[model samples]
Target chain A: MSEWALEVEQLAKKFPGVQALRGVDLTIPRGVTVGLLGPNGSGKSTLMRILAGVQRPSAGEVRVLGRRPGRETKERVAYVPEVEHLYPWMDVDEALRFTAAVFLDFNPDRAEEMLALAGLDREARIGDLSKGYRARLKLVLAMARDAELVLLDEPLSGIDLISREKVLDGFLRGHRPGETTVVITTHLVREVEPLLDRVAFLKEGRVVLDGEAEALRAKRGCSIEDLYREVFA
Target chain B: MTWDFDRNRPIYLQIGEEICRRIVRGDLPPGARTPSVRELAAELRVNPNTVQRAYQELERNGVLFARRGQGSFVREDPALVGRLRQQIAAAAARRYWTEVAALGMSPEEARRLIAGVIHDDKSSLR
Candidate 1:
């Protein structure tokens, strides 16, 4: 069997005012973590949204598990948006139930385990919870599903360093091989590099560089941070 | 199992070297349960995935053994340790020579400078 779980070819998307993505080609394999990195307004989120089936592309082809993005793809793709989208009125249990209801493969036991591991109370409301708790809740919800592709759109954005560290550790450690393919989009290049099997650096709606993380480093003879600065500087 | 990580070398390579050093120095003897990935990660303040890469590299090179369910153990081959040390030294020497030449230093001057640095290591001798 081929390793590629999500493959995109000449994928392009445009907003009314801007061309968000232009001819973006990507091939992410199964069981590997990919880092989608870019600066502000680089269309990382747009590409992620397209993969998650939240947004439609202007042109080009995309295949998740060798099919178009739709109900089947959505079922296999677990997406957490960059912005906080959870309902403020929903309590922890309600949120879990809501997610469980949406995804057919959502594992309640896994959600319960993650909630305990993250030290989150089952009854706490999303609005009343702290930023750390909110982030943890989102992560738990995304990870609870046994999806083939888990797309985290800036999972650690706006969190404190301590909380970010904890969240990263939890997400990295809890992954089960062959069952999950996690793609994290972030500008925090240094913090996210270690967890990434491959990295794609986007700039101005185009993928300027893409390769295996270690191979990219070897090719440039520089750290990921140095390379990032060089590419986007 | 304490490791002071540095920024220059990659984390996984450093981990492989540290494990090799322990094996060579007899700190982690053959068949010893050389710290679990979680334990070493906590001690070194590094990601467990990075530590896992280090262990993977060692296993690939035959410097460590894993008996599934049971954790990784230091390899019993003394010759493997010697070979690894030599390979590392060769790479270091090549890097040093490349830098020395880039600095426009003659072979004699570079050798003398290197020897002088070694001579200045008073703490190691003591």
Candidate 2:
């Protein structure tokens, strides 16, 4: 098996009017929490979708957990998209049950624990829950799965400050270090700065900077947020 | 315990320094079991690898010792803690001196000012 949990070589994706990704090459090792950061239209979402096995790459090769993004890889990879996917009619309990039914790796007991930690009501309807609660539920669903790789795209976006902390705490609580490889793509650099083991800065459909988080900070003599601003500015 | 991490420096170094301070302050007494890397990472909301780096650094410095599968612990040697405390104090003094020197103050003048401040502060006596 490859040492990397996710690997992309000369990956390219083209839309009708825009090139979403252009010859982007990246590798994320197993058991590391990597922050895939970039501005809008920087291909973060496109890369995430490809890794999740939802969208095929227009060109180049993509491997997740040493295999091509397909049924087997999808089963081992848990993806929480930027958009809400939960059925609005389903309550928190129903959503958990649905997720458990869909993925054999889903841990219902762990989901219950995460729900309590997030202060989410199992009986609350998905439609009635606040945007933050909905986000937390999504995180809980993704985290409860014992997937080898977890991908979260803009998980903190649109979340309130208080709920954001709760959700972040829930994430830390659910994740098992040295066991799962986590890739989080978000614009909130400052908030998630500390949690990143490695970081890859994407720009205009290409990777601009990729290195260990602490090494980058030490070399640049600045925080990740400052580095992001300098790179994207 | 809460740590204020500055963005300008490496986090692993900061984590190592924080644990050093805890050792000096007796917060982590000699022979005390240190929190696992996972636990510390969760508490600080940082990457476990970062914590592992810090712990490895500390271990290299002889400030911590790991007993395979049992977990890491503060060095049982009191002399090790004493030496670590002295090293930290010396580094702090050097930093203070550098800042004072940058202000064009002589060593004598800096000493006098420090003495005056300490004398005026009743809490320093404790």
Candidate 3:
């Protein structure tokens, strides 16, 4: 098996009017949580989309779990979009039951645990749920699946502080070291700084800096949030 | 289970220091089992790997030990915890001493300042 959960090299993506990525290279070892951080327009989501196989890179190579991203790799990878994608008509329990039925790797027990941890009501209708609860519910959906590589795109975006805490707290409880590799992309650096084992600073569709989170803090003599400010300053 | 961190320093180091502080404060008595990494990480909202690193460091420094298939525990020896307490105290004292020295305070003045603070009330120690 490849040591890296993800590897991207000379990767570039373009949409007729704009370039989303420009020759980016990144590699993350398995069993670590990575913060793919940058400003909103820095291509963080685009990169995530490509890795998730929802979109293809316009230029270079992409690998998930040492193989090209496809049906094979998709089995071991779980991708959560930045926005809420759950159906509003379905209640929390219905959504989870549907997911359990659709995805082979989904675990109902794990879903139950995440539901409690996220403080989500199983019978609450998706339309009646709070924004934060909806966000947490989406995460629970993704996390319930026992994927080797989990891709979370802006998990903290547009949520209140208390709800964000619940989302992060839920994620922390379910994440076991040496079992899954989590890649989280966010422009809000401070809130997720502590959960990062590694971080890559994306700017202008390229990685300007990347390193071990604690080592960067020690070397820069500042927090990752400050470092982000300086990089994009 | 609350956590406080300094943004300027490495969190794992701060975690290790915090654990030491807990031991000295008697909040985590010697021979007590430390919270499992997942539980602590969940409570702290930090990466499990970072928590693991802190536990490994504590084990390396003799403040903790782990049993296979079981969680880590604080060292059973009371003397070990006592020495650890002294080390922490010494570090804080050295920092205060250095700051006072920079301000041109003499040894006599420093001694008198400490004596007066304690003499004023026992609660001042807290």
- In the order shown, the candidates' DockQ scores are 0.23, 0.73, 0.85
- Clashes within 3 Å, all models in order: 0, 0, 0
Query: Candidate 2, residue A171: CA error in Å?
Result: 1.6
Model 2 misplacement above 4 A: B123-126
Name the 10 consecutive residues with the lowest summed lDDT in model 1 chain A: A170-179
Chain B TM (all candidates):
0.77, 0.90, 0.85
Candidate 3 chain A worst ten-residue window by lDDT: A170-179
Q: What is the C-alpha local distance difference test score of candidate 1?
A: 0.82
Superposition error at B21 for model 2 (Å) = 1.2
Q: Given candidate 1, what's the lDDT at residue A21? A: 95
Across B1-126, the per-residue lDDT of candidate 3 in tens digits comes to 447699789999988988898999988999899999998888787898999999999999899999998999999986987897898899889998899889999999998987887788877765
**Number of the top-ranking candidate, with lDDT as the measure:** 2
Where is model 1 more than 4 Å wrong at Cα?
A: B1-11, B22-27, B34-53, B68-71, B78-126
Highest TM-score against the true fold, candidate: 2
Q: Tens-digit lDDT track for model 1 on B1-126?
A: 334554334778878888887876778887888898866765665556668888998899898989899999977776876786788788789999999999999999999998998888965798
Per-model TM values vs. the true structure: 0.82, 0.96, 0.94
What lDDT does candidate 2 reach at residue A96?
91
Choose 2 or 3, whichever is better by DockQ. Answer: 3
